[model samples]
Structures are given as C-alpha cells and as structure tokens.
Target chain A: MSAPAQELPRPGGFPEIKYKRNIPKVGPSGLTLLVGITALCTFGLYRTGQGNLERRELEREKVWARIHLVPMLQAEADRDTYRREVADKAREAEIMKDVKGWKVGESVYNSDRYQPKTYAVVP
Target chain B: MSTYREPTLPTGKFVDPTPAPAESAHPEVGATSAPLKSAAYFIGAHCKEYNEDFMLCKNENADPAHCLKEGRKVTRCAMDLITKLRENCEKEWVAHYQCLEKNNQEYYACRKPERTLNECVFSKIKLEKVIPGASGTPIHLRTDSIYS
Candidate 1:
C-alpha cells in the first residue's frame, strides 16, 4: 500500500513571508515638526495671556476714571438740586401770590404724627 | 350717606432763594458723556487742584449751598480744559472722541485715535494722560501689546 496521504511532504519552498511591526522614530523632519508644533502652541498661549492682561488693564483704567470723576459729578448733581430747589420755590411763590399767610416749603404739620415715617415697622 | 368735600392743599413756607451773583456764575459744561470721557484724563491733569478743593469743600460741609462756589470752580475748570482742547487739538480730539462714541466709549478700542490725540495734546499743552493709582507701565505707552 502507498504511504499514508497525511504523511506527504509539502511542495517546493517559496520565500517565507514575514510581518514586521513599524516603530515610529523621530527623524530630522519629525523632530522639526514636533518643535514647530510646541512653539506654535506656546505662542498661542502667550498671546491669550497678553490679551487677558490688556483687558484687565483697560477695566482697571475705566473703573479708576469713574472713581476720579465721582466727586465732580456729585458736585454737578448737588448744583442741579440747588437750582431745582430755587426753581420750585419761585414757582410756588408765583402760584401762592394771592393766598394770605401762605408760605412755600415750610412744614405745615406740627405734630410728629404728620412727619413721614422713615421705617415701615417701629423699632 | 357721607358727603364728599374738596381736599385743601397745604400752603408751605418759603425760604429766600440764594442764587449766585451774575459775575460769579459760570456756565455748565455742555458736552455730554462721550466727549467728557474723552477729555476726562486731561481735565483731571489740568484741574487737579480745583477738583481737590471742591471735594474738600463738599467733605467739610454737608450743606450743598456751602459747596456751590467750589463746584462752580470745578465746572469752570473743566469747561476751560475742554475749550483749550477744542482750540488746540480739535481734529485729533474729535477723531478720538468720535471713535470712543462709536466704540461704546471703550478706551482700548480707540487707542489709535487716542494716541494721536494724546500726542497732540502733549506736544501742544504739555499735559500727559496719567492714570491715577496705576501700577507698572501705562498701557498706552506699551508697544508689545497685540491688540489696540
């Protein structure tokens, strides 16, 4: 009987196929790319920081300018109040010219009850 | 049924109105906010003494009447500064303030025109914009800033 078919030898050899893993290495171009990316990122961060700082400066200046002008503005408002008081008095005098014993701006009520209450609830 | 009666108005007593004399009276600064903000720093520089005096008067006296004269002086000083700025740096000042008016009165946005105006004012009147209580170099003087 012929040798068992399972024991038959394989056919003539072709070159063995090898599968190799690729390991990434940093060559000159790769190193240059890495450096370039790092630089760009750092510059972007720096620019953002500078922008924030400038904005802070602007805000500080605005607030300080307002603070500096407060007294002057308050003075202007006070002047307006004075002028309004004068105008109101003049208008009242004109309106009350015919009324006998009529006075402008004087409190007519003598009792504390007539005074406007300062607080909603008594302490 | 209750009868309805007309309510009588109270006759309030009057105090004599004390108006400032014609010679001493000064016209108020007519310019509004944008213009005022544009020239605020220069006004402060020019009218430091008057501003301080007015503030002092207000602090010393709670009565508005007592500080009226000082207030007038402050107003006059501000008016004078505005007039002088108009006379000397009209083009630059207008450009700066118009830029400010357009930019919601933000100083940084108008720094280009502001720089020009500041240069003109400094050259003409020798008044520099100095921010009070500011630490480090002023933002206007810096060249390295990325944005205006």
Candidate 2:
C-alpha cells in the first residue's frame, strides 16, 4: 500500500455529546417511574374493561341510529314494490305521461312524489 | 359474472400480541405519571379529567424522552391487552322494531326517533324495609310519596 489511510476529521464546529459507558444501566428514578406507570395502566384497564362484558346498546344517544337501520332497508324494498305496482296499473289503464315528474323538466304524472299515482278512477 | 373473492380488508390484520410493555419501553427512563391514565389518553381520551390523581412522581432531570418512551411501551401493552379482552363483546349492536314497515322505515318516523324514555316513575319503589347486611347498615323508605 502507498500512503497510510487517514480517518475523517470532526465536522465544522459543534460540540459533540459524549457517551459514558459506566453510567448506571438505568437511573433509580427512571426505574421507579416505569414501575408506577405499569401498575396504574394495569389497574385502569382492568377496571374499565369490567363493564364491557355486557351486550348493552348505547341507549342514551340522540340519534337512536341502530333502531333505524333495519327498517330503512325494508323501506327501500317496499318503495320498489310500490313503484312496480304503480307502473303495472298504469299499463293496464293505458295511461302514459312524460315521466320523471319529480324534477322541473318532465311531467311523469300530476304529482312529483308519485307519477300517475293509482289511476284507479282514471283521471 | 365475476368469481367473487371476499375483499381483503383495507385495514391491517390484528397482530398476535406479545409481552409488549416490558420490551417496548426505553430501559433507562421510566414513567412520571399514571401509566394507565397516560396510555388511556391515547385511545380513550375522555377519561383524562382524573389524570392528576393517578400520575406517578419521577425526577425532573431524567431524559424526558426516556420516561415518555417507557410510558408508550406500557400504553401499547395495555391497549393491546384491553382490545383482546373486549374482542368478543366489541361487535356492532343491532336493534329491532315491530311497528315499522319496509318503505315506512324511510317515513319521517322511522329515520327520526319515534319514542324516548323518561325516568321510570317506580325508580325508588321499596320492596321491603332496609335491613342490615354483612357489608353495611340498614335504611328505610316510606310507602307513599305524597305524605307519611
């Protein structure tokens, strides 16, 4: 080998933090804190979890959301059924109008909510 | 029709838990406050009002990161343990109603609450005169609310 290898010099100018090998593995204060934290966490979790075993609904909420979901599904199905029934009746009565009455553009029936509703008396 | 494979959940799978607090913490520094309360602050933040009552005392000069590191480790362990314990009971709850119909479900009454509960009038109904039990002393209540 030609010239000996050289180690890089310390950078431009900040004091470096020194590490002491002989420092106590864990300072006494830190150990004490850790013990205390562990104990508190254990206790709090145990206490909080006690009530979780019950299958109780959050009855006090204002929305009462859980009570509504199933009914909402059924309502959707029922609406489809009503729509089909109305359509069939309209065909039987030989009635037709510009559909999509709910909006400003076309007039499906006399009312927007239900187009050509129940043409029983055939208006 | 496409062959349907159940979609993999976007969320990561629940990992098998380990003895976390002991391993996760910084070995040198430790907690300066209640371990449970601090950890609970992470998920169950609503319980924080009582933190002072449970905080652990520790040296001020200790590396602040050290104590926080320890606290995080313990908190992780605690949360993992708590979730595991509640797994079976954490399923979403369902409610049923009889007086409703399919489309009627969408009716104004279905979406909005049709009923509410007030305090039961019989809340303090006394079955019998209070008597001493192994744990505490006895007390009594009168029968009628209006008088005597």
Candidate 3:
C-alpha cells in the first residue's frame, strides 16, 4: 500500500484494433495484372478471328480456280486425243501397206455387217 | 520345267509418229502450279476470246479433231500472256509466286506481294486480273478485310 499502486497503462492498444485502413480492397499492382490479362485475351480472340477469315478466303479462291480450270483442262485433253488419233492413223496405214485390197480404215465386213470400231492398239 | 510360253509378239507394225498440226506446234507453257496460279486471273482476262472460242468448238463436236485449231489458239494466247508478264513484271511476279509457293498457292495469304504484282502488271502490261463471276466488289480489292 505504498501510496495506492499507480495504474499501469496498457503496453499497447487492444490487440483486435487495426491501425491501417483497407479502404481500396485491391492494390495498384492487382489492377495492372487484371488489365494485362484482359488485353491479352482480347488480342488472342482477334488473332483467331483473323485466321478464320483467311481460311475462308483461301477456300473461295480454290473453288474459283477449279471452276475456271475445267475448260483449259478439257482443251488439253482434246489436244492429246487429236495427237494420238493422228499417230494411230499413220501406224495403221504403214501396217496395211503390203496387204492386198486391205483398206487401212474401212469397215472389214461386207453389207455393213460390222461397223468400224476404233480399238486402242498398243504400239 | 513346264513349257509356259508367253504369246508370240506381232512384228512389222511399228508406231511411226507424224508431226502434229502446224497450229498446235508451239511448245507448251513451262510454268508449274505456283507460278501459273499467280498469273491465273490475268491469263483468264487476257485469253477470254480464245478460251470462249475453244469451248464453243468443243460444244459443237465431241470429236477432238474438230477443235484442234481453237485449242492451239488458246495455248498461244496463254503463252503470250505469260511472256508479257515475264517481260514487264519480273520482280513483282517472282515475289508474288514465291509467296504463293510458300503458302500452299493460296491467293489470300499473299495479298501484299500480289498487290505489288497487280499494280505492276496493270501499269506495264495494261492487263487486269478480273474474276469472271464475282457478283459485287471483288474480295481482292477490299482494303478493310481483317485477314488481309
């Protein structure tokens, strides 16, 4: 009882009390990260769209080219056929030269019994 | 050993090839797929009349002998167009076709080089690449295409 015991002040404030404010829940670093992710996703979507458009254009071109190619290809095939026929006629003439009364390209049977058919003779 | 003889071969009937028609004597166009694709539209535009005539001849008769003259004309016209392109737009032509060769001969993938070649051909050769049946503005001329 030495002069009523002096009251000791608490060593610190109540342990449950917080000194700093958490007003803005997200920090500047977190906001930056969110923005970066959004931009990257948008860019990826744009690239995908661009790739699709290019693929469609390629398909269109292929179709157009194929349509236009028919006539040219037909003409090429015709030229080959004409050349082959000419060669065949020449070969037939050479082969039948010595045979008596053998017409190279005429029908072989009397009274149109057998019409002339062009056979694909191998050389 | 069994005497399994192959049939006796026929003799004295050799294939004596004759010259092709004079009109069809020109050498074939030597360009392969990529280069030909690069110049396809231009060739179409340039050879329209000859191509149409050849087709008409083919329609008249299925016999190829009937269309030999028209076919030769078509071949000549295509060769002429290729020659003109080579003479006038060599650099641009090479660049565009090389791009096409790299990108599977797809026209859309080589628009930049194609544009250069188109401009050159139009200026020097006075020939334009016209798609035959495109309804509206051709896709090639569109500047705002996202893929381009």
Best by the lDDT measure: 1
Q: lDDT tens string, model 1, A40-122?
A: 99999989998888878888888766755766676777676665555555766776778888887554568423232232110
Candidate 2: TM-score, chain B only? 0.22
Better of 2 and 3 by DockQ: 3
TM-score for all models, in order of appearance: 0.68, 0.21, 0.63
Candidate 3 has an lDDT of: 0.74
Residue range B37-123, candidate 3, lDDT tens digits: 888878777887888888887777767767777877787788898889989898999999999899877787798999999999999
The 10-residue segment of model 2 chain A with minimum total lDDT is A53-62
Q: What is the TM-score of chain B alone in each candidate?
A: 0.80, 0.22, 0.80
lDDT of 3 by residue, A2-116 (tens): 6887787678854676878878765568879899999999999998887676556656766766654545666776766667666776777887777788666564556534232
**Model 1 fnat?**
0.38
Clashing pairs in 1: A103-B12, A103-B13, A104-B12, A104-B13, A104-B14, A106-B13
Model 3 chain A scores worst on lDDT over the 10 consecutive residues at A111-120
| Candidate 2 vs candidate 3, lDDT winner | 3
